[model samples]
Target: MTGSPEAQTSQTAEKLPLPIRLIDGLSGLSAALAAAGLVLLALNVFLDVLGRTFLHRAIPGTIDMTINWWMPMLALLAFGYTEKMQDHIKVTVLLDSLPIGLRRAIEGVFSLLAAVLLMFLAYYTWVDAARSAKIGETTSSSPPVMIWPFKFVAVAGVIVLSLQLLATAWRNFSGRLPREIDFDVDEAAL
Candidate 1:
């Protein structure tokens, strides 16, 4: 019995193995972390407001915790996952007008640039984390929690984003990515 072309393609895709699947899974985790961080931020704000309005006492260190810690984590963690899903905002007026080959070439160049930027970010953040860890850096707020963890999170997120950018570049090089005007659109629209 012979398989259909679609089935053959599906099997070939499946044969690409578990690491890409794991990377995709990690992207999902990053997204979940970002969502959780947002929820936490909102909750902190709500609690602070309640405390200030009704209880006549603001939540101590809430601003420090949410702003200094949660927001950075949220933004960093969301970066790679959002890019992986092609959910990042784009002004595609120019890109959309370009020929497929030219558009892909442009995308490849941009992906390489993004990967380099992310690598630099990861390197600097790792150094910052190391310095903070060595010096035992702590927030100047009431609770005075250690700040190195947040820096480490930033480094991890940047590394993940860098990997995703490299993956995208590889996909583009191999002609795997669809020749679509907008990445968010369905493949049929390409």
Candidate 2:
């Protein structure tokens, strides 16, 4: 609360309710896993190509691993990060022109709807993951790798996203949501 909005947001996020902080920490961990997955994926592709071209023997299960595991980790794990950062694309022309109250109402409603949808997604994905684990489902690889873990990742990602959406909805309705930075507003008025 002592620093700029961005700094305050980062600080306050850490001090949020325990559940929020827990989910936030999990999101951070997911992001880290995504980063590591990216590195491993790159190395895997490189090694697979090299082995295939020169050694005439590709890395076993590279395609399946990339498609089934690495790609999901890379893509799905960033849900919370993107939501927290508000990095998702938004068509703001209409919102920007609206009255502040109306804009907040719209944002809050949308956020709530998003939260509901993500909650459903999280529930269904968790159930799917559990079913997969129970059935000992495996990827369609030569040596079929277990795939339930990736389904759990999807569940985690959606859960984090749902929490973030709920937080956004609360902030929006409460008029505590941070506004987009407008560096030129003051200067333009002057």
Candidate 3:
């Protein structure tokens, strides 16, 4: 993303190990799906409003669909991509006062710890998802809508998030992770 196509192909980024590349791809996929879901969710709500206003009839399952399907798809899948982009909110005033080496070390350790904790979370969520799948979990709309698939989406999100965290931990420990660039935008300029 930082360079032209030819530059990137010739750069060290493309040489990252296969697992790292795969995790990056997974994160990208999650982001893409989340974006697509956002579009669809907006369209769905628009249609629901249009139908009700024009025909005096509401979409039967629109509310359920929004709550069960689109919400989880958007929320759960965003974590890894955000983390990979180093876009998570940070209050670094205290860390900024620390020696660079110690700060990096602390960040690295916490990332590693978080990754481990999320692995356990992913496993537990998978177990619950499997149970939901086995039971054919669904919403109570007039026509039952399967809701279990989105449970797996949550699990995938967690797994990808943890993997990215592990990768971050590695970069942090090795001092290869660049400090995230901060951009100050003037609200009036927009």
Candidate 4:
């Protein structure tokens, strides 16, 4: 009636409740920004390498930027997108044998548990970010990039990831999200 739990896509996204849609929007936005961060990171690395090879000098704070900024941005920011796409590795061997209703219920319970755990992670991450920001942290590179601002990136990423987990829990609870996740299926089916 609602979702087949067989396929979840943007089309189904449109049918989601407002709160879920809003969360999805935020998740999508964070993911899009993460994508941009990835592009920027690649370009930054490329330029740094080129400068080192041809100009005989590496970019002043390239290492610091990569470690402090780009890597976190790329990794943390896309977490929600990964969850939303259900792209993470999952072991469904045991789940496959259960009845559809039972499977959904089990999945829903696990999603809730995972979401709760992520909430704790987000909280601790926020505390760390706040401490970093309060200290006005900076990398010890020649250019001295500010590390404090980028710390918030971690907070945002964790928050979005937790939210995405909550959304997933809700979907699973509603029994509207999935039939089976067959990793062995043909790629063309996807």
1-190 per-residue lDDT for model 3 (tens digits)? 6867567544645666777667777888998999988998999999999999999987878988888889988988988888877888987767766776788788889999999999999999999999999999999778787889889999998998999998778767776553343333336866
Weakest lDDT window of 10 consecutive positions for candidate 2: 177-186
Candidate 2, residue 116: Cα displacement in angstroms equals: 1.1
lDDT of each residue in 1-190, candidate 4, tens digit only: 4664444565676678998888888998999889988899899999999999999988888888888898999899999888876787888879867786777788778888888898898889889889988888898777789998888898899889888888888877786552335425456955
Q: Per-residue alpha-carbon lDDT of model 2 for 1-190, expressed as tens digits?
A: 3678779877766556676567557777878888988999999999999999999999988988898788998988887777666677877766766777788789889999999998988888888999998998897768888787788888877887788777777767766553453322355565
Error of 1 at 37 (Å): 0.8
The clash number for model 3 is: 0
Model 1: lDDT to the true structure = 0.76
Distance from true location, Cα of 6 in model 4, Å: 14
Superior by lDDT: candidate 1 or candidate 4 = 4
Task: Compose the digit string of candidate 1's lDDT tens values, residues 1-190.
Answer: 2588677655645754466556656777887888898998999899999999999999888877886778987999888787766667877767866777777778878999999988998899899999998998888877776677778888878887887777667666665642223434356865
Regions of model 2 farther than 4 Å from truth: 1-19, 178-190
- Mark the regions of model 4 whose C-alpha exceeds 4 Å error after superposition: 1-11, 178-190
Worst 10-residue lDDT window for candidate 4 reads 176-185
Give the CA lDDT, 0 to 100, for residue 99 in model 2.
76
Rank by TM-score, descending? Answer: 4, 3, 2, 1
Steric overlap count per candidate: 0, 0, 0, 3
Local lDDT at 92 for model 2: 77
TM-scores across all candidates?
Answer: 0.78, 0.82, 0.85, 0.85
